[model samples]
Target: MEKCSGTTKATSKKRNASSTEASLPDCKKLKSKDGGKTSSNKVQNKEKTKMEKVSSKKKHKFLGSTEVSQSSKHASKKKIQDGWLEVTKNDKGQLLFKDFPQFQPNMSPKEVLQAGSFGGTYFRPIYSSVTKQHCEDEWKELPEDWLKGLNVPTQVASSTYRDRVNTYKVKCGGSLEMWESSGWIVTQDPYGWFQWYCRFYQGRRTKDDERQIGRWAKCAGVKGRWRNNLITKVVRSGCGFDNPTVSPVVRQTLQHWGYRLTKEDYKEGAKRVKPK
Candidate 1:
């Protein structure tokens, strides 16, 4: 497995039975018309050549040099605006962005960190499969103010997930490998969507912006499907809009995506779900 950039960082556990089998075995030999030894040797040589190639490809696929991705040629050009990380929220807890009206995340990246998200393991030291590098201190890239009072051990880089560190104080297992394979984990943000959000918030727009925004739209936007799903659960359970006990997992998930479920959002999200 690729190093999990998020909650699913790769482990150094002992390999299973499969790791012991590195030798190329000659199972069966192709027979010539006369069943000659020379032809048999040639066939064995060909088989060994093919097996060696396969083994080499596997090695190359997993052990790619980190310098290529860590020191990436596709790095987003620096463009710090007047108020690069400035955030102005509407009175009702809605993010207002003039450039992209379609994208709306209720919480800024700062708020997400302050309120506790990612089980404090989002930025844990990780050997990233996407970057082929052991990335531990990447979280330092964020604005210092964002991490002011937060403890790096339990709230920023804890190796293990601590449910108590989350805003909801609920256990949420968001696998990095799964999202990475689904094409959401781009080379720009190996830690997945939230990392991308942080960079975007810091006023760095790259080729991955549109795609990242699209993901937010589907997960936490005005008519986002995940938002609608949470609303439906809240309504169906007969719980109040602010009830923490109702769908805590989804709430935590939204926070991880840089959103907070506000009363206004709950009210609007309610309209998307019917009585049943």
Candidate 2:
């Protein structure tokens, strides 16, 4: 569903999820036929603040009902403070943790940023609601290789939210206020889930890991509601797995969660849908 090219390129140092050390292909602007109305009403695009726009028009529920675990414990401050970041990947394109198999994210943080997510403002300066501290350059804590080739101002930490920076060219998630109000902003990664993910990918284990992984599962796991919902829509639309016009908003949401719907995943979801 995400077909447009991004502004920056980043390569993985570890063996790529593609079973080889392959660089991510440059995603150029994809040609489309449906005049951009690829999704049903569920994926309609409405011009709104980048953080406020929801993928679904009907009952746009975000971090609402699912209660977040109030986690005060976290990974050793010593290791994180010592500045250690190690990134690895499973050959299957899914980062699988043996202890947390339910948390299988295909994209690395580098891939996610390179794919153009979060309106290019995810790591921007912010006064955290959880930490109550003005945090700047916290993104620098991430692996430099992952942040390579990224424009810090416009691509990594833009003060302003630019929808054009997103590969989908559509806003698809809830506001930061919603995240904080929902009690999902843990102090360890006050910016949000993706921040936690970047650290987690680099061996920063935390007590908050389970809760964060559960959230990722709810959004992108095998039976993840958002993931499954988008798959069903794809099956209903009868589009190819990479159809850019189909549910761009939902695709963008999944992208932020570090999962992209693959052809194999689409076919598998179709079988389950057909049986129902």
lDDT of each: 0.72, 0.72
Best by TM-score: 1
Error of 2 at 141 (Å): 0.9
Model 1 regions lying over 4 Å from their true place:
1-85
Judge candidate 1 against the unseen true structure and give its global Cα lDDT, from 0 to 1. Answer: 0.72
Give the per-residue lDDT digits (tens) of candidate 2, residues 1-276: 133222222234232554442443222123245564333322323344333443332112311213323332232332443333334567667776665777888888889999898999998888887888887776776667777888889989888888888888988888877999999988767889998887677555657888889998888988898889888888888777778788999999999999999877777877777534
Error of 1 at 209 (Å): 0.7
Scanning candidate 1 in windows of ten residues, the lowest lDDT window is 74-83
